[model samples]
Target: MTSRVNPQQPSGTAPVVPAHRVVVLLFEGLQLMDVTGPLDVYTAANEYGAHYVTSTVSPDGGPVTTTAGLRLVPDLSLDEVDFPVDTLVIPGRPDWWAAVADTALVAGITRLADRARTVASVCAGAFPLAATGLLDGRRAATHWRLADDLAARYPKVEVDSDAIFVRDGRFITSAGISAGIDLTLSLVESDLGPDIARKAAKFLVVFMARPGGQSQFSVRQSPRHPAHSVLRQVLDQVAADPAADHGLPALAARAGVSSRHLTRLFRTETGGTAAQYVERIRVEAAQALLEAGDDALDTVARRSGFGSEETLRRAFRRRLGVSPGIYRDRFRTTRPHGTRED
Candidate 1:
């Protein structure tokens, strides 16, 4: 049971009992955007007639400074939180690894998570949450820059670097920065349905389901051409058309250099073997095709220069840790978080 709030009336003017109670756990050195972005989504949802009460809580019920130098005051201390939590949000700070080492903070989070129906982390917040062992054997997401570190730190938690957000059962984790909004919108859709979610998204001037996942924003997706002129044209050709013949001999011949010289340049400049670079480029190409269209796997393979569906699968697995189909499935879930963000 919930209260219907009229937009014309002030929220405090009424004794409103929201349908959902969202508790955001604040910490020192946290990112301000990680806290505000998702909360704004919930606020926009409430404006559109949804009943969500979002509150902030800290370890000691005091003000904490963000990395950006802004100060935030929580509604109460974690110790004073007695109500049932519908969703417990964890926002990340820059020194999140250190927070994981803070036993008092980890213990507080574990305690709240135990009471919360659903748990979520924004950006690097996954680090602290994972430390609680709640994400063990669960697929999670974090900031792209911190994804490898998160995986390295918690071997039991499956880190998804590609997704803006990942939902594994009741635990939801979002990627860095603004992905928290995408995560929160997806939650809104889950609770309030697509119609109201669309209204909220429209008000915020953001897509209900954004077009693609994190691959579009990844640094690895950038073309890593060296400053040298000799390798420029060959790299350009490979990037412009992935399906073109880009064998070592062909590349060397096209660049008018010896194969040995070309290999040396690739290793020296790109820090990877020519074959490895080609495979990664091909995988990147395949990722584009998979995200953009409903092409068959074999079709995508040929277009992306993989030659066959099996080869494409192998390449995707090697590069992205998932098959081409799953990659597409994950990327396409953004029809305003239709299923992709899920």
Candidate 2:
């Protein structure tokens, strides 16, 4: 016999629920915000008979301390738990990186991932997901600071530092702290529908639905003063023509500096290499195309420096975890300059 659950009732108050189970993995020193963000999102939707039953799970059902020192007691341990999980959420823990590497927590997470229908991570949690080998050959996103490391460490996984979240089939990942909320909202939208997701975002008072194309943080670094004339001129040109295919050599030639020198100067000034900074500019331009224009895929592709429609599709899949058409359909509006970003 099968049992059905009333979404209005909290978990364990009734018989076994056929509702979607969302298990949040709690390792020692988990980020409280990451854990709470999704919990809050699902909690808000529960009143409408759209419950996403959630729980905190640890390797041992013992008490664990969050990064903020709040003690959390999980409902189940890895060995004792047997819930039908539709989604497994791994919250970030920056300080626990070394500890996770030294412990069996990551291995246990990998095991849980195998059993769940979908696996998600917030911020630094991508480290463990990558460690589990689940992210290999998939497009994933993590906190910007950790993106290079995630990509370099797992060469098979294409990492996008700019995305707020990446949803590669069943595996979803988001950038740093607050981005977890955006990711959760996206999940809510997917599970319940856009109306519920919008309501949740509104209840939380988050301005606008954050489109996956919007950068985790904008790269609007500008010169401090007119005294920095030449650099500022180059920056304006780059901003105006991000599709111009300018690399370190070409940019350096335009700026009258050696490529090596230009790279060093760019890193020193912008806190990123010339290539990294230029890519940021290109991504910003891509966002414009996604939001502003209804140009065909090939036209948008060429304008965004992705070279071809196929190339844009590959990057779009890796960065946003969806195709261009789907993204536009979900977030685009017919009004002039009516984009999700706006």
Candidate 3:
């Protein structure tokens, strides 16, 4: 959604309303949801008496087919646009890396972003923005699967794959498909008000607002392959029971190797030391417990294999950058008043 903040609207007064222009950039093979999700947010807001004029644009302003074999006809072509845009959104595609190499598309986006109040992207759309140098040295977010690729391609840009969305200056980026809705809702909240955003979210049946820094819903796993049968067995055992006797000596015994040799092999095969893997697995266990219920901190600590509350706190702070209590508050699921379904 496009917006221009009015200085005349004082903190407690009614906001000066204007019709904001929101333009979505489209191309062949774009992801359909990336285009529809954010559009739906602005449309819902407009239904609530918010003035959001939304439209779509393409290189030639023709019918663009998506990767899913669906077609989208644009409202305007780049050459036909005469008015200034308040917001410019670039949606992503499954084959987004191919789009990044399109110098013409990158150039067009660069020109539009220079004139727009805010430039945003969904998922791998960050690649094209990075190509134009707009995201250089700026924090950005994208789908977790492509986060490493984005960071590797654009060394200057700080990629935060864990985030659902990230706002750096006037440039905003969101994680995968449904996350675009979250980013648009945040923009609606920023431009209109929390009440309108909440109303829009309710109509859309989504959260009123979700934090940009929330982690993506995926479990972390070791990237490296196990080099031996014993290593695989040890890994499985640890995953099954984080509270098991997994110290260096015990793990070495379980693996039928010396402690020093186990350490070396674990690092070589798992790309992390045994102790590091154990700690990560323990943190994952702790995260599950924290999200499932409101257990005491000490109880959570022991159940997750941290042994003590202080140790759990330290581990949480080091790994997740939040205390156990804060993590629980953010992630714990709530049941309906009359039913247990979440």
lDDT of 1 by residue, 69-114 (tens): 9999898899999999999999998788788988989999999999
Candidate 2, clashing residue pairs?
A: none
lDDT on C-alpha atoms for all candidate structures: 0.81, 0.74, 0.82
Best by lDDT: 3
Q: Model 3: per-residue lDDT, tens digit, 1-342? A: 232333334556553467788989998888899999999998888767677788798888888999789999888887776788898999988887788978878888988888899999999888888999999989999999999999999999999978889999999999999999989998997888766777778778776555576567633453455768878888888889998889989999888899998888787887778888898889889888977787788898899899999999898888766677766643432322222211
* Alpha-carbon RMSD to native, per candidate: 6.4, 7.3, 6.0
Worst 10 residues of 1 by lDDT: 333-342
Cα deviation of 311 in candidate 1 (Å)? Answer: 15
Please say which candidate is ahead in TM-score: 1 or 3.
3
Angstrom error of the Cα, residue 161, model 2: value is 1.4
Per-residue accuracy of model 2 over 93-189 as CA lDDT, tens digit each:
8863663584588788878998899899999899888888888889998888888888887798999888888889999999988888888888877
| Least well predicted 10-residue stretch by lDDT in candidate 2 | 333-342
- Models ranked on TM-score: 3, 1, 2
| lDDT of model number 2 | 0.74
How many clashes would you count in candidate 3?
0
